[model samples]
Target: MKRRDILKLAALAGASAVVPGVLSEVRAGPIGHTGPYWITIQAGWGWDPTLFCDPKGAPVNATYDKAQIAKAGNIPYAPSNENDAFFGKYASRLCVVNGIELSTHQIEAAFRQMWTGALEPGYPSLAALLAAGLGGGAPMPLISAGGFEETAGLVPRTRLVGAQPLDWASLTAPSADMASLFSPMTETRIAQYRRERLKAKLATSLPPGIKSVIEAAEAAELSRPKLEQWKAHWPSPLSDDPSRALIQLTLAAFKAKLSVSANLWWMLDPAVTDAAQVENFNDWTARFDVLMDEIEAFGLDNSVILVASSGGGRTPMYLDEQMKGHWSVGSMLLLGPGIPGNRIIGGTDENLRGLPLDPSTLEPNPTGVRLRPAHIHRALRRLAGIEASAEAKAFPLDAEDLPLFS
Candidate 1:
């Protein structure tokens, strides 16, 4: 294809999903990874548990009565949105964990705690850790559209939101008419000279920091071609919807073996407002349903482990009679072939405090510990079979190991 045509296609479809640093140059055929892909979709801004997977009654939420709560198999969900349809379709595949107690209800702290199992900044997100821990040969390893961009420098962090048109003219050749400015023989000499200079510099003593940078540059050069090869798998006629576009690009990377885990974000429509909270949440669920369909269509339903959650939970009561404030207790939904679904672990009291669950039974145990993101992360590391990996050990989550997936 003409380089211009490729740039035009990327611009029109927002191909911001491309890998960076080492993801430039010539194109080749796809490279595929076969099993156990990881995806985490987090709802930006706090979401209301009373209106989502964890339904509460009366003074908690005057919007819906407790009597209106509905059940899908063993799960009880708020009657808002297309809950009946959504839950009916995936309840058997879902492991809903309510009452996630956070150390703080503030947005930033909550986000850090929610995904990294750390209350402090600087920890890599679960997505990053998983990609670094379990990643085997994927070029990008971890990609994020939005939500917890930190990778703790453990893996290459690729973002699928700001891909710009490359200077293909300069990249491929000096001009459109010519493939190269020099003959193949001259090109070979030039390459040898460049390598000799790089090797000579490396052989000399240098500052530790500069030496590391030079070594990293060499690694980047080596990985560039693999990233280029992944271009053959980019979806044609990309979807216009942002959410769908993100999913499409992510799946393409997954199928091409360029990435192992991705973090995507969605938010309640700001225009929907509190008066239409139901509509906002409905929109969220509909997108999730579409995600489910997209995965299944790619024949990845069985291989993808999905986690859907919010940065934090909104309080049941409205603040300033306009909107809900952050609540310390939140919830998360896990689904995949690996987890036994149709299970509800943990709970919240009427006042919206997290109730503890017995570590052994995963049942409500007032005397037991409240479920936290650390616990979930610990369980997730085990579930992905990477708890013992050096990557996991380097950035540890000092959390109690719980049998969350059983």
Candidate 2:
């Protein structure tokens, strides 16, 4: 495998790749129809819950003072100038999670803990563990686009830093050129001959374990139709809206069954990377509207696990009218299978301190456990219907599974 490519196949007990003449055996789950795709959209810099999920009006955060707080079913959301449309249209499918406290207030430590539920390395990302468990035989089990999508080696994952159409082309061919993978084959018989020759050699010279690799490559070479279909469905990546461009790629990977799941981080224009900038939220608002629109248009709302979360929340105590420092408590949203519509779980005070809750009832309790990202993730695993899998068991959440989804 190439250095950047992640391919960790389970080695057969007795199969030896080192021996030139000995045949190696291998086993992998078979691929079939898959749905309820899992996705995690990490906004990177935390969002201010006071302006949204953990709604704290005025005195606490003045930015959303006049922005009417809208309630869709049971979910209360601040109808900010930009994101009102989403709340009005899809709040019925949303489950807002608030009062999430991170492990620390320091930048890097908090960022790591928010996603991986740990302050240091060695903890597998929830995305990685879930992908491997649900991934039957997807060529790419996990696809991580944009920011910090560390795999920690639980399964194969692909990271797309920027535009590189040829990267998709390289799936089947040795060269990173689209033409090489999908060019017309006028001499079909010659190709058949080569394949038959390889098949014949497979019984003798080629190790059995290597056969699947060769076959998969050939399968990908014939995937030009799927590529063309994606081209018709996605928008131009070089457009003004970078989020659509990135989301288009992510959606294609999932729809094409190229991967069992994908974790997409939205990297705003360098100028708008700061979540503290109110204007950035406007950009995000518009893009998020388009995101939900496309998801509904593509008919993925019921068949995909759409999650939105961040490192932490920006403090309500603003440095100025525009900038706010990081706060320990953050927010999360879950929308997909088994997640009831318009249910808001947990809460924070006007100052954004998490309230303790009855673990079983998920109601406020004076002396109960506080919520965190790990607790949410543990519930997420159960929602995906794979909490008991060995891959999931490998990364045990220290606390008992949170019953948020139920």
Model 1 C-alpha lDDT per residue in residues 253-278, reported as the tens digit of each score: 77778788988877745422355657
TM-score of each: 0.87, 0.75
CA lDDT scores, all candidates in order: 0.74, 0.63
| Model 1 clashing residue pairs (backbone) | none
For candidate 2, the TM-score is: 0.75
Native RMSD of candidate 2 (Å): 8.8
